[model samples]
Target chain A: MNMMTGVSPWERLIRPDRVHGSLYTDPDIFEAELKNIWYRTWVYVGHESEVPNANDYVVKSIGPQSVIMTRDEQGKVNLLLNRCSHRGNQVCSFERGSARSFTCPFHSWTFANDGRLVGYAFPDGYEGQDKAQLALGRVTRVESYRGFVFGSFAADGPTLREHLGGAAETIDRLVRTSPEGEVEITAGFLKHRVKANWKFILENECDGYHPAFVHTSIFGVADSMIGKLYGGASTALTRDYGNGHTEIDLRPEFRKRDAPMSWFGTSEERLPDYTARMKAAYGDTAAREIMIDGTPHVMIFPNLFIAEIQMFVIQPLGVDDSVQHVTALQFKGAPDLNRRLRQQTMGSVGPAGFLLADDSEMYERCHRGVLARNPEWIFLGRGEKRQRQDELGFTVGHVTDEVPSRGIWTHYRNLMEPI
Target chain B: MLSRESSATLMSAITAFLYREARLQDEHQYEAWEKLWTDDGVYWVPANGADIDPERQMSIIYDNRSRIALRVRQLMTGKHFTQTPQSNLRRLISNIELMDEQPDDGDIAVASNSLIFESSLRDDTLWAARNEYRLRYVDGELRMASKKVILVNNDKAIYTLSFLV
Candidate 1:
């Protein structure tokens, strides 16, 4: 219990039906979240395809702290702190580049791409100093699952597999879309800046309820068949796969159509070459199911979001600001499909997207609305009574339910509350 | 090189066309702006930088003629929230230069700089960019064949840019 407020953290901030508004605006709570959540968990760093070649490095952030994900000489991906150990200067300043070694500008301290101290300008000055100790600080644990890299600051906690839990199947489904069983993130990212708390994005990404109201303009409910995928009458299900991961499973609805590639708004005739390749790779039945199922609309807790043809990684800048970096997923042997994916990504995502622009506006409006102080709690009680476990043991509800947000908050409360 | 008089006339015509296009955009004259583009128009606003390939790398806005019409239709819907209460916008076009005097497939290239001032429901934002245009004459009327906007800070995080750049 807090000595000043005389209230336990979970009771004061999070509850089953609602969460306190202070969780979105308070600086102290944001700091605590940085410690308890972002720093402790296995936060996604970068994709292995991003650094496909040796010496390639991309600078990314765990929370607010900058770190570099580099491909060493042996092609092993390494996550090292961007800071220089000598005088706390940033070693690499470029967003991404292929460099032989990172040479710090301040003291001319040079380190190899894999965080090995190669040499320094004034070596005699540190005659007795242990150069091994001064190498770049590395994250305690680094793991990769099918080219998706994640890093953890804490030495021990949940492994990436344990953290992903049942959500790993969603990732497997995405990779299987490629005929070669590989997905490449070669296309650059589109960073959409949102003026709201980072958690809003986590909850909103899997949210099927608001798409009907929020994106009515894009979907054009009167004539759009896609409009029926969400709202009260839709048969789609929202699943809370344990450990804070969740999915808006549209398979039931897609299966109702009984058409292959209907999820992508395409069909067998249009992509015959792709269909043939998929058949050759995974055989006819599995490829047919893969095309029908499409990609998963899911969030891997804390950061990663797999949105069908695109992937989004949310970066928290502060209590009331965040940036969502998104990229169009490229299939390994599907050139025809990759072209369509790029065009669709442009139409549906980024700052000028038809769908995302309205969502961005709502996120900002929600942040501004929370400043009103009267409603101390944000309602998340929708579908709580009807939610039940599916055959996969995941908590399931209607597509328009708050089961995902409730699951996220439940996991968050467990992390924040004293054990 | 062309004679000085011909150069002056070309400059004047291009400048007039740019100012008129800017007015159409600032006034939200959707139909008039739509008419200004050729049937095969391509509107591109590259993300990261202007050098990346649009086909391989992601861009902020990359639209062919059909997509351009769709964008206009979405804006005209009166429901796209980013522009429900349309952003009050005015932009300054300057440093107009004729990059190519020779017509390549009936199109001449021109370049200019833009400083757009936008006031929306949230806050005011100033956007700076270099705009490159491919202009062509269709039945004695100047039409835009292509337009590419390279934002000054395209490499960094950018806010909602729903309005035409």
Candidate 2:
């Protein structure tokens, strides 16, 4: 285990109570993380709804690498490296578009959206050069879980389902919230940058400890009753789903808010109609459970978070900066419900929203403070001992516990440490 | 389009109003800025396409008059920790032009560009936007009927935009 100190590097760096500051600031560690964590894990690309029609494509990135998620002529989704094989130029330029082929602007080395090299100028320039082999570098593995596409770069590892673990049921419940058992990415997305490390944003997503403090202004300034209801939610919990995923669930009363698409809570007026419809489809118990479950905030490790009808895709830019892409999801069959969802998303977590603004400021402050080098250890000792493994083998903790972040560190150490 | 002289005068008047509004924002005059809006005013900043409906699509900022006031109220309160030290701002407004007018409704539309210089603790940022404002003459005073801000960095990853720009 030891080269210099005769002890595992992670043993000293990542403890149950704390993680070293270098985990957030070291350039070499960031690179190592990209290779071991991001590259090795199953990474979400784009939802199938984003590329609904043939030839429609959207660009997605993991750290420094950009990839295209496209629906080819066959209507199957393909995840291909955006880099052109010939000159390493990005194959597709637009954010999302319907295109037959992605032509590299550098030398016009055109490849079909399916990762097939169909044509190139001066094909005989290098006679017998295998164009098929030279197609856009396809990711090692690509799979879709209910239209949510994900890709992995490593040649071998866990399958997408294996990678997801208990997070699968959470996702299943998420998409099933749609009356039609489907949802679409309708309202587009809001891309924001944070001045701190990428992990900070991910941790902040389910950090049940901060909302009461960080979003206090939101409660104070809100004119609507729903804000007050959220402000009044006294009980909360953060569940550690197996395989590094976390779910932060608030008390059932909070989900009792009388808003349409009330992921947090539902009211009596709309409950009858919603429950009636759901009962007709899945019976009373399932419908009631869904109603009571409210909105579940699920975080799929390395970087994907879905909560409150929105999805967050995080990209690490450097040791000190990260890009956060937020998309508002809409119910497929419920136009009115979709409208409400979009409005709620707009009011909450975008760049200027009541929540994200405070969080970003905190992130930057943390970044600044971490540079001090004197504090050495960042205390995560919040409710460490109270956390325990659940019946499903998950480590569960109360909302105020550092359980989620600890899970992240545990997973990070597992991935980064030598086998 | 109005006559050249009328358009010029309209531009000048609207320019002064906008500059005053910018100054109010920079000074963090929440109450005064709230007074600049018509009761039915809408403040919208589209996230994706400039023309997308803020009601049905994701927007950076979309506020009815009431919510706008509430937003300003929140920022004015010390609880909005992002502005604890209060972000320092200076805006440069240019290319003010009378783009459209609805005489019957007593409304006029103008277009302009903005470059907002913002500074906070240990950091500084420059924000650029194409601003379109619908001005309504109410009670013999021109008030903001609606403001649509098309941020230049809308498509990119941006940090906090808590303060008014």
Candidate 3:
């Protein structure tokens, strides 16, 4: 047998069937994940609508590396390392603003929006030096789909579209909800850190099983409010879309049947004159389709998540910690009252939201439990006995099952191992 | 013009109210705090320090009574996973000032500087906020119309603030 055989550390730590506890508590494994998965995959940076004009920039991170995504004077978006080429000083320290060029504070080295070396404070000492070879390092790949921008540190990975696969439809639906065919990242963001494994969040988001039990308080409140308003019972519906994507449909079911789309109050109670307003704005069917669909939440793998009413981005800070940044999106031509309603709803679902407070608390509890004794693995066998596949190559389970979380971990484990 | 005695009394009332609120929060007297707000009171924790508009700038916490009650219920629930290792907080409120009053709305705008020392099992956090309280007398009681908190480190990346700030 080989010297590094059956009892090897790698084999014992990670296997096709189970993952070791060290994956959650070990710093070394965390570092490897940062380098291999976060740096290699297409990580979401920001949205094009965030920097609508030339020279607008936003700061974000991929792993531990700080990066600035900017719209150049030529209207092309570029993602550049925030570090200065000389002495590794941070090039753009501001969180976000409109600037033609960023000047390093340490040595006064300046870089344009496209990350070109524009000017230097003092040129006497560097007369003979090669300035062309010393430009701000650019990201390997910077791509955008439906106005959402993403950057990858690796050069040889699959194209952004290929990486997204069947997930692009969700993005399309998000943008399509607006008659303008685009969405912008709204001003202001809710930034908070959760003391839990980053993967736990991604797994829990589409996990429909946790709501009925984990969010009993939310359901109670919803029952009181929803019952009073609609005189119906609220139901949480979970559907598994192929390619590691899932959707959670939360709609009130009345009279022992899924309430018709009209009862949810799209055109009747919420917007009594919605049809007339739509005709005055975008015509007839356009308004009906955009306003009526009831799907609320969508998740794009590796860290981009969206709710029809809210937008959020999750960035891994450490092995056992992650930062969740939330923004509320608004239609460009949406009325002030509609925008305020959206903002109120978004705030109710944000970090301080009734639902999120419980979710975050649960994440902390999970983190505490995982750090407990010498357990080799955490079980993901909720629906293993009934793992059924559909047309999309995805598995389905009961509304309150851990099937989606299991799928997330399965994909995560696959991406973690070397190909 | 108001007499110096009246002004001092008003200041004392404002300072006492602020201290009482902090004490209630530290003691987890959430239900009592809920009673201090008007029916339509808004609690806002601005994401940017100098933001003038809550509509345009993001806030850390913006909740009304209903949402605040919901949060209280969740915290009391056994399934609130994040609160497993419950967080303990101590707040220091000082530099109280009665800035201005709107005669038309009968609203008194009071500003105070505050520092909160929060401790979880693994981390200790320090937060400094400039708080503005818009108070109005309703039915002979001083009730808050809006409470706005602007943190000094507003624009910086932050950890989860799972409680009222």
Model 3 chain A lDDT-worst window of ten: A225-234
Q: Give candidate 1 misplaced runs (Cα > 4 Å).
A: A3-7, A221-224, B100-103
> Of models 2 and 3, which has the larger DockQ?
2
Q: Among these predicted structures, which one has the highest DockQ? A: 2
In terms of docking quality, model 2 is medium
DockQ of each: 0.69, 0.78, 0.53
lDDT measured at residue B138 in model 3 versus the true structure, 0 to 100: 84
Full ranking by DockQ: 2, 1, 3
Model 2 Cα lDDT, one tens digit per residue, A1-419: 68878889888899988988878888898888888887888988778999999989888887768888889999999988989999888877788889989888888889999998888988778788877788889888998898788889999989999989888888888776666777688578888887888878878877877776777777766744333333434445677775678887653444454233354434535545555565566676666666566556889887888876688888888888888788777766656556667776777777898778888888888888887898898888887888877678787777768888888788878888987
| Worst 10 contiguous positions by lDDT, candidate 2 chain A | A223-232
> lDDT by residue for model 1 over A85-132, one digit each (tens)?
989999999999998799999999999999989899968888888888
Which scores better on lDDT, 1 or 2? 1
A best-first ranking of the candidates according to their TM-score comes to 1, 2, 3
Residues A1-419, model 3: lDDT tens digits: 13656454554555544566667777887887888778888888888888889999988778668888889999999999988889899988788899999999999999888988878877888888888788898889999998888888898978989877767767776665454656766656777677877777777777666666666656675553332221123344444554355655443232233332232333334544433554456566655554555335767777787765677688888888887777776654445424554555545555566667667767766777777766658666665665566567656655455566655555666666556
Which residue segments of model 3 deviate by more than 4 Å? A1-3, A6-18, A224-268, A272-290, A336-341, B65-86, B100-104
Which lDDT tens digits does candidate 3 get at residues B6-71?
Answer: 988888888888999998877667678777888888888777566647666567777776766666
> Which parts of model 2 have CA positions greater than 4 angstroms off?
A223-233, A251-279, B1-9, B100-104
Ranking by lDDT: 1, 2, 3
